[model samples]
Every structure is written in C-alpha cells, then in structure tokens.
Target chain A: MIEVSEAGLLRRRSVVPALLAERGDMLVVAGLGAPAWDVTAAGDHDLTFPLWGAMGGAAVIGLGMAIARPDRRVLVLTGDGEMLMGVGSLATIAVQAPPNLSIVVLDNERYGETGGQRTHTGMGVDLVGMAIAAGIPQTMRINLPGEVEALRQAIHTSTGPLFAVVKIDPESLPLALPPRDGAVLSARFRGALLGPAAHLE
Target chain B: MAGKDWPAALFALLQAHRVRQVAVVPDAGHAALIRLVEASNEMRLVPLTTEEEGIALLGGAWLGGQRGVLLMQSSGVGNCINMLSLAASCRIPLPMLITMRGEFGEFNPWQVPMGQATPTVLEAMGCAVRRADAPEDVAPVADAMLGLAYNTFRATACLIGQRVLGAKTFGIAPQ
Candidate 1:
C-alpha cells in the first residue's frame, strides 16, 4: 500500500462546510463513514440524507433524487473507497444525464473509517479519469482550496452529470453522526421536501 | 393472454400504482419490459450495470418520494442480497419483478444454483415472494405485489416462472 502523507492535503472538516455554505435548498446525500460525518459536521439538515450503512449507495441515491426532483440540485458526497466500490454507477448516471445531479468524492487516498489503510487511489487509480471514461459531462480533480468555489458553482448551476474527486488529508477527526435510524431519516427528509403531504404519500 | 402481452400488462399495473421509475439490468427474460420502460416518456428508465445497483436506485427513488421497480433475472438475486438489507432494514418499499431461470428445460447449468435459491433468499431478506407460472397470472401477481409494497412499504417480489418464459433452446435461433 502506498503511504499518503497528510502534510499538504485538504482538511475535510474545512472543505465540506465551505462547499455546503451556499447550499440553497439543495438536497444532499452523504455516503457512509467519513463523508456522512463530514456532512453532519457541516450542519445536519432535514434535506441531507446521510447513510448509516449502504457502503456504495450514495451517488445512485443522489441520481434517484435528481431524477425525481429535476428543479432541485442534488449533491452526493462520498469517500474514495465508497466511490470506487460503486464506480459503475457513474456510467448509469451519465446515461440518464440528469443535469441537476453532482457527485463529489472526498479522496483522502485511504479507507479512513476502517483504519487508515491505503486505497486504490493512493496506488495511482484515477477517479476523475474513470468518471470521464464513464461519460459524465463534467469531471474535475480539486487539490487546492481555491478551486472549491468553482466546483461549488458547477454543482449548484451546471448542466451536468458532474463528478469531482477532492483530495483531502488522511488525518482522523471527531465523529459527527446524524440520526442513526433509517426510518426517521427517511421520513424527516421526505417531510422536509414534501411538507404535510409527506405522510399522505 | 399471450406471453407477449404480459409485459405491457405489467407495465400498466406499475403505472397505475404510480411507479415513476424503472431500474433494470439487461436480461432476456426482462427484455420486453425493459423496452416498454425505455419507450415510455412518462417513466424514467435507469439501466444498471449490475442488479445490486438497481436495489440502491429504487431505494433512493423511494426516499425521494417516487415509486420505482426493479426488473432482473433470478441469477441477479444473488447480486442483490447484501443490498436488499438496506430496503429490508429501513422498511423501504422494494417491488421486484424477477424472471425465473434454471428450471423447466434450462440449458445453462450455472444458472441453477442461484435460480433455485432466489425465492428462499428473498424471503430471508424480508421480501414476500409471489410466483406467476402462466401468462394470465403475471398482471394480477404484479398488481398484488405493487399494492403490498407501496401501500404498506413492504419488500415484495413477483417471480415469473420459466415455463411462462418458455424453455430456452440450446442451439436453435429464437423465432
């Protein structure tokens, strides 16, 4: 396993909050493990559906949301390991080509949740290249803090099945869990989106 | 009812139940249904590379306040076992239309294990399995499964028998 140094990598705690700051009613789906905590730390809102499990399901869930609510921007934040597990989903998302959806992979180059073991990304796997190959219209690799604003704009306003791999530090941080109960999270999210009619459905 | 009519009937039943999304992995058994979904402008047809992705896709669609269905072969059931836990545990409604294989004149030996195991596996995963052995039974079984899934948020499976699909010949080209 190739060792990833934490020296110059972006802090997930800092990047997630910044990206989500201008989120105006955008629905968010956070993948399992660190990405879920990252979104919760950013701010736990009813609009954010954070997965307690379902390791590789985040992006496709975002795809479903994007398809259901075309007017609302849907953003998926997931770890590199999780993204790699369901990487084939990018092709499906691209084929459907929902302009409202964007996927951001927090590529820390390791599986941080299961102990900092180096993942395929650390061994030179190219996630952005894979996204491009998968036919996503827009793809990027963000290594600098300054590039995040552009990604934020693209996510909020671009015509895309967009994908980005944001390089982050491998350093462990405090756990910030959202509601663990899947039923509660699902109901709360649906209620927030559909109002009183949520129960009727 | 002819075998060709069952796919359209099933599609109509799904529409009546307000299933706006159809997530599928390509298979000969589900080809007609897939084509029907793809041709429809009213429903979103999501073609998945693997059957497991269909499980997540449908779950996500449900969470987003849309009803969806998964169409796959019996062999694909193995691929969906672990992912089905998400729907089962969360009580997310999953309505699956599975086509049976490896029974009643199946030529492929590899398909037997998973095909024979499909119903038991789905049952273990908390899905109520209903079988349709004849062309006429497809729509009613599908209707009941959809009702069970959408009205009560239960995981349900409608398994179409291989006899309904007709036995696949080893060498002869299909007419």
Candidate 2:
C-alpha cells in the first residue's frame, strides 16, 4: 500500500514509453486494462503479450517465460489493482528467483477500468514493502521520472527477480488496445520467440 | 490392477510426457508424487502460494516452449476458476492432476461443498474433466488427459477420486 499525495507522481503515458524505450529482444507481459494500453501506446511487438483480462496474472506469466528461456529478459508491466490481486505470486516468484525476470507495477492507486475506485495503494498499501517482505532480493518504489531509467536498466541487466512499483498519476487515458484475440497474441509471441512453425506444434 | 504404485507410475507418466515444470500447491494426497518431482533432476518444482498462479505460469511456460502440469486438491480448483479463462482464451495446453477430497470417506464436513462441485465447475469452465476411482486407472487416465490437452491445446484434468487417494481420517492418533 502507498500513501502520498498525487501532487508529483509521474504520468503513466510518459513513464511507460520511457521504460520501454530502446527495448530490444525483451519479452513483455502487460497486465489487463491500462497497463496493457500503456504498453501498446509505447509500441506493440510480437514479443509483447498484452493481456485482455487475466487480471492478476502478468508477473507469474513472466515468471514462466523467464524460467523457460533463461537467456532472454522478461518484463511484466501491470497496475496496482492487478498486482494486489496476485500479491501472493510475489512469494512464488521470489522462491523461483529467476535472474531474467522483472515486474514493474504502475501504481495509479485506482482501479482505472472500474470507474476509478480507489485501490489499497491510495490508502497506503506499500507494494514494494510487500515485495521485500516476500523475499524478493531487489525492490524499488519509483516516484520520479529519473527513477524509470534506473528501473529500465535494471530490467535489461540486473540479476533479478526485481520488483518495482512506479507511482504514476491516475489520469484515464485513451485506449491503445492490442488485438483482443488471445490465440493470435499467443501465436504471434511464440512465432517471434521460436519460429513461425512453432505455433503449429 | 495395480499395487500401491500409482504415484510413482504417475511420475513416470509426467516424465514420459516431457513435463519440465511441476506447479504445485502442497497437498497430502499428492505427497508421494510431489516427493518424486522434488527428487527428479529433469523437472522444476514450483511451489505456489495458491493454485491459480499455476494456470498463468504454465501458459507462459508454453509460450516459451516448455510443457508443465498443475497438481492440487479439489479446494484449490475453486481458486483457479477465473484464471482458467487464460487457458481457455489462449488455448493453453494445461494438464492438471487433482486428488479428490470431501467426497468418499471424508471426515471433514468443510471439504464437501467444493469437492462435490469440483468436476462440474471444471466442466463449466471448458475443462475436459475425467475421474479415476481405481489405483490402476490413475496413470492411464492422466495420460489420456495430458494427451488431449497438449494435442488439442485444451485444458484437461484427471480427478483422482478419494477412494484411490485414500480419504483423510480425523480420528484420535493411534497409540
């Protein structure tokens, strides 16, 4: 849970693009709703799997991908509401401790899709604290624009299971939706990672 | 007709299927198989805080070109209801081995509700559900479940009946 005024939080649109800038060969799993839009706005790629409605699954999905391909980095970009729903997964990920995985929660402190209901983070639930307590070796709470670069660098180079919560201002933005078909998304991702013939398997 | 060897036989089946990851929520009914998975050099045992994570985890594993399975009890199946949509929507090949509880010879009254509803709920969510009441049927049924899942990219589960798993007793400890 987080407790801070929305006075100086980074804008999500600016922050997501910055986090994804110069992204090369990194496999991304975006959480449902706004985080999905945020990633799509940054730029959609075959390697990116933007979830339509697996509300609490982004991190663990990255965990599976990270475990399967240790050579590639996996990033899970999600929102605070989604992260809280699957908070127990932090413990699961920590135990696995995949060096190639990183999770970044975009904390707007509101369930953006559900008519802006205040999430626990708005009332001061520390997600980073939960991550640390769950035994994740690296944890960061990014409240500034400069910190995003550090988080991005960590995603590409750090030995992690790293967890970061970027505190962003809750401004409902225009939808940048990815393809709604899960099969197509899954097929494209697999085709890019493996080959075009891989999905047929 | 098999002896008390279905757990080991089941492990053999998983190994034969090339199941590289075992996503499990610890259940006493699954203890023997869990022990085998723990000892196997070829399998990565992922202990989950809850069962739902297994659905997404295995889906990701499949995305990265690895096969996996989930092992849990009936109660945990309830936790996986919403997450099962990931498998259904993505056409993820999810094979699950679930040991039954709160059905036959169950001493705990609390286990009954979910246990009775397990198969129905799974079926409602588009899982091809099967059951094995005898020791000999366990491995074969599971093999069929896995075959259907991976071959068709469908989520399937084999519910190992309480009779096969041996129901939990709540009586006083033996002196």
Candidate 3:
C-alpha cells in the first residue's frame, strides 16, 4: 500500500530487472495477469513462469518451492487482486516463517485479469496494514524510486519471509511473451529448480 | 463407535505443538473443530473458499517449512480433484485432518455422494486414509498421521467418521 500517482508506477517498472539481477536461484512466478512492471525486460532475460488458472496463488506455489528447495531463494511476482483472492495465504505464510520467500507485489489497484475491474486494493485498503496484522516481520511500502533504495537494501540484506509492495501504474508498457503453452513453461520452471532426477524421484 | 471426547483429544494432541495455522472449508460436521480452532489465538484460522484450496495451502505451508493442517468435511474430496494432481506432481506430502461426511446412516442426503467417494478418492491419489473410530484411538492416529504427512511428503489422511469427531448430526445441537 504505497500511495503513488499512476505515473509513478510506470517509472519504477525498471526495478524488476534490478530485483532479478540481485537474487540468485530465485523463481519469479508470472502470467498475463501481472502488471507490466518491466516484465518485458524480465522475459528478455528468460525469467518468468506461468502457473494454472489460479490467479492469486503464486505465493502459495512459491512457498512450495521454497520448502522443497530450502537451499534457494523463492520470490513471487503477484498483483493486488490476486493477493486479495487468497488473502488467508498471508496468515499462513507468516506462520511458516520461511526467510527464503520474498513476495513482490506490483499493486496497480484493479483486477487486471478481467481487463481491469476496480478493486478495493486501489481504493485505499492499505495492504501493508494487512501484512502487519498478519504478523510479517517487515513490510516495506515504496512510492518513489529512491524509496526502493531501502527496498533493495531490504531484499539483498534480509533473510526470511519478507513482505514488500511496490506501487505501479494501471497503464503498462508494451510487453509480449512466447506463444509457448503453460506445460512447457511449467516443465522448464520445475526442471530448473528440481533437475531431471526430480522428475524420476 | 466413538464419542465427542475423541475430537477433543485429537485437537488437544494437535494443539501440543503450538499448531498456529489451520485451514478449514466449512461443513456442519466440522463446525465444532472450527469453533475450537478459532477459540485459540495461538492457532490462526484460514477458512478457504473450497477444500481444494485448503489442500493446496497445506502443501504450500509445509514447503515454506512450516506446519499447516487442512480441516474439511468428506464431501470436499470431490472438490479436490484437480488439486490432487498438483500435489502428486509436486510430490508434496499433505496430511489432511478430515471430518468424514456422508457415510452409513448419514441422514443428510448430500453427504452420501462424496462420503462414498472418500476412500476411493484418497486411495486413487495414493493418500493413506487412517480412520479414528473412538476416543482412545484419536491421539495416536492423529500423531501418526501428522508425522506421515509431513515426513513422507505424500498426502497422509485421518478419516474421522461421525462417532470419532462427534456423534452423527441430528440436524440440530443436542441441548
């Protein structure tokens, strides 16, 4: 729940690349549903995986990977509407206390899934407020580029499950993904995390 | 075969580890345990939209390296169809504490379908269903089921019938 103008969200879109660059062995879950927060650059780097029909369940899936591969970092790239759909996930995540999980929400304040229905998230719901109440150790909300200095500092330096929200614009930049199906992406994603032996096991 | 005290004992054993998160999809049969879960602040309650989500979450929490339990009535097994695929493919061991629904002599017409499907559904997915029929068996069975679910990384089961979790519902509370 960082309150920023729609344009502010657009300017900070590049931060996605920076976030991705800093973390090693972390999986970023994404789909057409997520706002265009430099997903173009991310896809350019071949770094996103789309899951099944569940729109807001990325963090839940990411949690699975974190538990399976305790050695690596697991990050979930999600939206506000999806987060709200599985709101109970927050309480569950806090209880698990996995320091390897870092959830980056590109909150544009609408259900971008169905082509933008207005949502309570954009209506001043204060998601950070929800995280705090749910018992996350740290909730970082950033509206400006410089605020992300702290966000970067927090992610690279921190350990354990952390909640950080970055406000983005509803209107996004041009981005396109491969014509590849969900299966290919899932297989590749799972293979990357759990090698071929994982399949046999 | 069992009595109300059985569910209480199972809850107390699960309650032993500071069981902080419980995910429940509502069912009248499970209402008592749900109420017990909510009554304890140490155990935060996550009431999901469907039992499938509850299944997904229990696995998710375990992966996040945390302990999570799924609470649901037997009928929810039908709702868990596709999700079982995700769990199997991921090889996540989920230990679900189910309040069995629609079994022999179940007066509610709705419980019959999924109640009948319960055993087959769990078996088909390779989930081991352990029934706790009386008060005495509740704790040991629950502790064993919890361990198998977490340690085995496959879905472990506690299929609690009417007598164990509580007596059969007469459609109203007994005063």
Candidate 4:
C-alpha cells in the first residue's frame, strides 16, 4: 500500500488558480476530467485548450504547441492517471526538449473521474522518477504548498522540459465545465493565439 | 521513379507542404523516410512509443499552426482508435503514412487482423483512406492526401502496400 502525505495536501481549486494567476500569453492544455475543470474554474481564457476526452495526450499536445510556437510558454495540467497513461511521452518530449514547455500532473492518487478509483500513483508509481529517467532536465514532486511557488516559477520561467507532480486533495469539487464543442474551442484558441487571421484560414 | 526514390520524393513533398513536425513509432517500413527526417535540421522528428500519441500530437500541432504527419505500421492503427476521436470531432488535420502488413507474402499471423481492418476503421473514424500499392503510386497518393488533410482540415491516411515495402523474410537472424 502507498501512503499519501495528507498533512500538506493542496486543494485543487486554490492550487490551480495560484499557478495560473497573472498568466500572460501562456497557452494552457488541460487534460480531460478534473484538470479541465480546475483550469476552467481558475478562469477560462481563449488561449486555454481544455480537452474533453483525450485521456493520455495532454503532455504531447503541449509539446506540439511548444514546438509550433517557440516564443510562447506552453503548460499542460493533467491528472496523475492521465499522466501515467501517457508516461512514455516524457521520453518523446525530452528528446525534443523544448524550453517553452512545462507539464504538471495533479497527483490526487485516484482516478477521480472514474469513481475515485485508486491509480498507480497510489500504488507507489513515481511520475517524477519516470520523467527523470526519461531524460527530462527538471523534475519535482510538490507535496507542500510552499513548494508550489517555486514550481510555478519554474513553470513560467525555465529553460527546460520541466515535470512536476503536484499532490492535491482528492476531495471532489463542483464541475466547472468548459464549452463541449471541440471545434469551437479549437477555433477560439487558435484565434486567441494567432489573432483574427486564424479565423480567415 | 525507382523504388528507392519514393521515400526521398515523399520527404520532399512533406517539406513542400510545410510539415515541420514528424511523429513516428519506428517501423522497418518507414526506415527510409525516418532517416531523411532525422537527417534534416528543418523538421522536428518526434519519436513516439505508441501510435496513439501521434494522433494527439498532430492535433496539437495543427492547433499551434504547424503541420505534422504520423508514420507507423498497420498494427499500430489499433492503438490510435480512441485518440482519433479528437481529430475526427475537432476537424484536426492528420496526415498518416501507414506501411502495409499481413496483406502480401505474410510471415507473421499476428499482423493480419488490424492490417485488414485499417481502412474500415479509419473511415469509420472520419479519416479519408487512400492506398498506394507500387513505388510510383507513393508520391502522388501522399501528395493528394496531404492536400486533402491540410487544405480541408480532414484526417487523411495513405496506406503503402506491403509489396512496395518488400515483404520480410521468415526466420531472419537479428541484425
């Protein structure tokens, strides 16, 4: 059995906004389920691309964005379950090693969307270890709220493919859903990123 | 065009189409194209562990205003099924170059099922499928598919036949 350190477990609501506060020109990719809600709850922006159902793809998507727009910072916020599903992406991203990309896994230790079932993280799967092994330049496991500021700083300003596993309380929150229409969401994001010329295309 | 010229010609076409990213799950059939992409400093080659990651990667690439292609074997198609929904629903441009398996001079029984199902499955997921059975057909089919994908924001697949890839011999020693 894996023991979670509950003493300093951060609330998803507070942590997400704190990380995203004053985020300017940052393109965000939220993994499906809870992380999507967390990002929307923080504040839905035209630049935020909240995924509806792509379970294990958030990081690689962020990598694509980082590669495409090298000038902008790309942050992927996903759940531990989602991160574990696409863990191999760490190696892929590491090889490219785009300096503009950062991935944060909200480690709630359970698959919150699928009835709170315990995930591999709860069974002692270390995402940070896996990322480090995969050659990511920076890796962190954030168990305390104090560590969040440094993680947030690293996310906003780091020359790296940075990986952070943020331990959050598993307590379910109210669903703060984004628009369900994938096309609309994508168009809006592209418009926000590329301006009005995006819609002309 | 000779058999060896197809890969280089296809690479040239991808560059012409502004495909800056190439996501691939390494396969023997894609070896030539992969080598060209790797050797070129102009394109970024993303090596994926599974084929499904390529689907999402291409979606994100399109969203960021960069074109990309997914290269994989027929067997990897099964891995991409669920992820294809993202592209199909959002109208993300996905250009897939899949090498055929289990259709001609077959040695492995394991490759048949998904290989046969590739077209139907991709079509059902809203991808336009086109096949290339000979060396000469490769470039034109790829060019047409890339145009369909990027121009109309449609997911397209160009399935290169096993005959074009040269069927693998049975019981070959490991290199």
For TM-score, the strongest prediction is 2
lDDT of 4 by residue, A1-201 (tens): 112345657888888888997798899999999999999998889999999987899999999999999999999999999998988899889988999999999999999988999999999888999999999998888877678888889988999889999988898889999998999998999888888887665
Q: Label model 4 with its docking quality class.
A: medium
Per-candidate Cα lDDT values, in order, are 0.88, 0.92, 0.65, 0.89
TM-score-best of 1 and 2: 2
Interface RMSDs of the predictions, in order, are 1.1, 0.6, 5.4, 0.9
Tell me the tens digit of each residue's lDDT in model 1 across B64-130. 7898999989999998888887787667889999999988678878989998999999998888999
Q: For model 4, what is the error of residue B172's alpha carbon versus the real structure, in angstroms, after optimal superposition?
A: 7.1
Scored by DockQ, the top model is 2
lDDT of 3 by residue, A1-201 (tens): 233454546343566665666556555655235433355455543335544445556666666556545677666767788677666677767776777777777777877657788788878798788888988887888667677667665665577687877777776445554434544554455455556743443
What is the TM-score (0 to 1) of candidate 3?
0.64
The pairs that clash in candidate 2 are A1-A124, A1-A125, A1-A126, A2-A124, A2-A125
TM-score of chain B of 1: 0.94
Number of backbone-clashing residue pairs for each candidate, in the order shown:
0, 5, 7, 0
Cα lDDT, model 4, residue B54: 94
Model 4 scores a TM of 0.95
Range of the 10 consecutive residues with the lowest summed lDDT in candidate 4 chain B = B166-175
Candidate with more favorable, higher TM-score: 3 or 4: 4
- The number of the candidate with the highest lDDT is 2
Candidate 3 residue B26 Cα shift, in angstroms, is 11
